[model samples]
Target: MKKDGQDMRQEGALKAADLEDAVRRADPDRALCARFLPASVRPDVEVLLAFHTELTRALAPARSAAIAGPMAGLIRLQWWRDVLEGARTPDHELAPPLLLALERGVLCRETLLRILAAREAELDPQPEVSAWRKMMLDGAGGLQRAVGEALGVRDAGVLARLEACGAAYGAGAMLRHWPRLQQSGRYLFPGDEAGLRGEGNAFLSACDTASLPSSARLAALPAILAERDLKRGSTQAGLPRGLGDRLAVMHAGWKATRVFQRSGAAAS
Candidate 1:
């Protein structure tokens, strides 16, 4: 049976909604921060984040299976690269929205490639501390840049700040998830636990979220919880599970909203 144009649009909408829910379940911190964005771009933010989550999940088989797992994961990552480069097309749900994002300039090919490269490196044997640190920073920071671009932020300074914010958050996340990663047979920084913490702290110290332009606040908002999680030490990998964690994100998002409003008024 042939599907009409309206039917196709409806199907796309449903898939997008399902993808958003999946992202909420898979990456809750970023999902919560996404709520603070303007309605006009919230979907874009959510979808881009889902892309990040998908990239992470692509490594699951590699982490689990014994022999063929890593190779399988590498092939999956390569498939995404082919799709992004227009070398292939599959009937995947996320591909449509992702390609649309790339076409609309909301995402850049280079940033996405960097993310893929980082993931590719993850499949390799454990890296040196410096190499691991670079991979984490580039992967996380690249996602931040993509998010900021979706928010219409083009300022070099703001993008740099976003990168720093994401790097801090990434380091803290690695610490929090160290146990889980160890269980999965993944050693990011090897035995240098203290060094990893120092890297996160240094990145956190360099981040000035208060000075960020209002437009980029949501993109950098995860750093709020990153600071708290880092202070709490690396006992668990999951997001902080309490009303307090929710309130902290809410408070920072609220303040950023106020700034956004003031900036909007000034521009008008």
Candidate 2:
């Protein structure tokens, strides 16, 4: 079962490439992640983000689980086990950095176990309806706390903020994807779709309306606002008026609009 030396190196290079690509994709979140980090500790915070980025993708490919059935989505579970067990048949790209992270002996094993447990909710079909939310909350917190430790932040203030951001991001992601989970009655929270949809509708309603842009377009507009806004206005300057309306005109005129958000939001 042993592989050739050249093949091992090639596999390692591919994993590293994958990891780098994932990192680049998550770069958009820097504004949010950096907000809570102290000037001195932000570098470490950035490093920990690499961990979260990897975890997200680790779950993403499991989206194929929709047709594959919830239980069959256990591909990601095996991948995590494969990671922690150091069985690098695929040669984990993260292994080198994580090994270096462990050189200081700061990250806890319990932290990873919590991540595994939380992620298990997504895989397990038999979980009690009410147990899903608690599993996700606790599991997400565990991973964040683990990241905090690895980053060497001992101050109580910074720790709490990091954990808060972690919980918020984790909960938000699950909520964003709740509809699909609801379809299978496999929600991360313990509720049926009718109940879940009402709650989701209410929660989403609470988000700020001002986040929309280009112009003060309708809530359902497809403006690609962030990048478009940047092009129209400098980082030092605020957004222009009527940009949303203009973008709407552009899309509507050409009939070129596509889905604004991802599948979960599209389902909602």
Candidate 3:
């Protein structure tokens, strides 16, 4: 029995290490942010991020698929939905770690479905801007909500703020990836050229940074990174290279820590 238990423990550890490596490779920015999280909750956050990466990548082939047909992408998304709904285990390697995360309450079925739905919407050739915006907000907001839950944040108000932060983060991400979308003959913003020019600023302006709970701020740190990337004129071409990007991430972390400290002092 002891030997069996040891083998199981080793297997679990190896699985976790693989998940971490996957996250690091697929979503380096979020993986970097995950480094600042408390050890106990870090894996939970990493799993959520890894799940997001999986959903995002699953749609990559469809982005450049001929407009007349998107069946391939649709099928991929359906498979993810099936897995989340417990139709069957995922055939992909990423699914096992994600399943473990789900069992641990690091993720929930409703939020996972929301994320999948957002990916499905992207398959639309001419998705309504409003619908797309709503999907992005839902997907991003759900992620923050899950992170907040993992961090033991139960306040409805704080969760709502986190959702807003997530939306802002999503908007910034869309901007960052604008070049890639354009190159693929796909666009997400709602408007003419003039409107496109203003969209990034509009999203940044709408972020309600002040209302976020300090304890949950780490969940929204990506918003700060997004803002910095926008200010630096980063696009799908790439983010600011080297030291500049590193400093931006560090600054965002420092800001979150400072806010948390202030909130703690006020509570006392």
Candidate 4:
């Protein structure tokens, strides 16, 4: 029997909720960051993040030779491209809402393509430090900019800050996941542990979060969380949780407040 319109709507809602839960479990830090977005836009942002998580999972087999060859990964990547281009219907759980976002103009096709290109770059064999850094910047920055756009952030200056913070956040994440990445025969950095830490720290320091306008702070909150987790080892398991993560965001917010006050005084 054909499902009624109400049944179809209910199914779609359930699928979206399931995707949100999957994203939260797969990437708790990003899920935490999504909480700061306006309620109206939060679901779309989470769906976008969920799409990212799906991309990462598709590459998992390629990252580990024992699992399978690159064929599966390539097919998965192409599937996403086809879905985004409207050449194919979305078959996966996350793809429906993602396609809806695209149809609604909440997400840009070009930006999503840019993001996919960044991930594809990771398949390069033994990428040099410069190449690795480029991948991080392009992949992470592109996604951040996409989220900002969805949030109605159109100012060039704010978008630039979002990209910078996103790059730094990506660097920290790579550093944190280095151990597993190394074990899988993939290196986040082309060098040793010390070199990875040094590179990631430099990236973080170069990003002036205090320069972020109040309007863009929520969009850039992950950078603050990344900074807090940078020095710590991965053995602790999945970024600071509960009160710890909350406190880090609060501290960053306080710093932003101070900057705003100083700027006001100077203007006066």
Top model number, TM-score: 1
Best by lDDT: 1
In candidate 4, position 39 carries an lDDT of 71
Model 3 segments more than 4 A misplaced: 1-14, 125-127, 192-206, 234-236, 239-242, 255-268
Ranking by lDDT: 1, 4, 3, 2
Q: Write the per-residue lDDT of candidate 2 for residues 1-268, one digit (tens) a residue.
A: 0122111123333343343334445633332333333344443334444554455445544555556664444565666557665664535544455544545555554556566666666655345744654554346545555655654545554444434334444444444445454453443556543444343333233322234221112211112232233233223232223545354435542321122223225557
Q: Candidate 4, residues 1-268: lDDT per residue as tens digits?
A: 0122111123334465565666677777778678666677788998888778767666777876655766677678888889888898876656777888888888888878877877777665455888877776667877887877786678887776677677778877766766666667553677776776676667666556666665566677778766765777465444446587677876765665456456558868
lDDT of each: 0.76, 0.43, 0.66, 0.70
TM-score of 1: 0.89
Which pairs clash (backbone N, Cα, C closer than 3 Å) in model 1?
Answer: none
**For model 4, what is the error of residue 223's alpha carbon versus the real structure, in angstroms, after optimal superposition?**
1.0
In model 4, how large is the Cα lDDT of residue 65? Answer: 64
Query: Where does the lowest 10-residue lDDT sum fall in candidate 3?
Result: 1-10
Per-residue lDDT, model 2, residue 139, is 60
* Better lDDT candidate (1, 3): 1
**Better candidate by TM-score, 1 or 4:** 1
